[model samples]
Target: MPSTTGSATAPLRVDARPELTGDRRIAVLLSHGFTGSPASMRPWGEHLAELGYGVRAPLLPGHGTTWQDLNRHTWAQWTATIREVFEELSATHDAVVVGGLSMGGAQVLRLAADVGDRVAGVMVVNPAVSTLRRDVRLLPVLKHVVPSFPAIGNDIKKAGMDESGYQRTPLKAVHSMMRAWPQLIADLPQVTAPLVYFRSATDNVVDDSSEPIILGRVSSTDVTRVPLPESYHVATLDNDAPTIFARSAEFVARVTG
Candidate 1:
């Protein structure tokens, strides 16, 4: 059976070449969340690719690995990597649309703000924009005084559903995300591309505050919010994934056309 646990040494690759032709179609750059691999975005990318849209899902830095590896990298590294991928995709295709899961979604928002004119549209799934509470403020202290493994399983209710099954979340990694949150929140108003926001009703990772923060702040004239009622934080791999894939395909088609 194929490994569902993901990998640290080996990164997941999107089977994108088969879907690409010389049609000069719109390009789609898919980004995964913090601690996630390109595999997380593969379904959406493949679905878009099948429709003759060029799709690319690049693995973020320090991801597809153990939590310790993730702790070693900063949010900026991941953002830079995705930005480069977005530029490459935009240069190669006629129109460019960017999408991501969780933190990847946050990064995409930053990308839209920083390079709005270069992008045709944006598709975000459970984009994390705000901290659920000030308690996240404690992360900085915990990373030094406590071990990350002991507290790892406490946050996850559906252990069986964790594709990576990571029991050890790098304390520093969670802290890094928290630090990045403030900047993403501040940059929300700069986004000018048409936006498609997908949210999971049962998500435990990102709080409900995200919807208002994104919907109320982004400057995009066309902002569509779709609720994923059947999935959790990793909705891309859960029950409503097909909905995400299909909706994303439709959104890409409409925006890029």
Candidate 2:
């Protein structure tokens, strides 16, 4: 059963706990996408936990709450939350693999760049570093007037599946993310950890532009790009979720073993 214990001020979905496995020596920090709660990464975290790996799918600072709350926070708060968790895990774990979906992916990439060889490996699904949309250029001015736009969640091909993310896209928060993009791209060369990238074929949110930018800039020699044919943007809950789980397990073993 999905636990509904969060307050109205911060409504968390069922299965959105900061989970951990019995084995704490090897940890995996899994991050959910922007505007998304830990619910989006819960299934993937649980699967890894079942395999005796430590998993932590933390809810970002402003997320799992109202969209208005997200507008009040910036990308720095979100990254700070993940950095604290990663540092905590890194202190005790012999090896750590950081993985995320969408914006979560970008977060992990930034971590990998900052931490370098300390991160055993990296995995991401539909990671976004840049946008192809022209409207994004207007964000600097539009954000002042527009509180939010349409929601970007539930981009899954699997029918009836919900990611349990925010219902609307907070323009102010989106602008903060945009501000962080250039820095993330600039630091990409610092990331040398083994990377396993999963790209969905029909993603409506993140376009084809992001993947090439990441692959071209990263210094990692061990890089694998897998295609998710059946899934959409949020592939963690989509059809190829099993593939993601299985391949991720293998990727971790190969790099950390």
Using lDDT as the measure, which candidate wins? Answer: 2
Minimum summed lDDT over a 10-residue window in model 1 is located at 1-10
Query: Candidate 1, clashing residue pairs?
Result: 8-65
Q: Alpha-carbon error at 165 in model 1, in Å?
A: 5.9
Tens digit per residue, CA lDDT, model 1, 141-245: 888876464323222233444445255667787787778777888888889889998888877777888889888988999988888887888787778888888
lDDT of each: 0.74, 0.86
Candidate 2 C-alpha lDDT tens digits along 51-170: 667777888878877899999999899899889988978887778899999999999999999999999999999999998899999999999999999999989999987888888999
What's the CA RMSD for each of the models? 3.8, 3.8
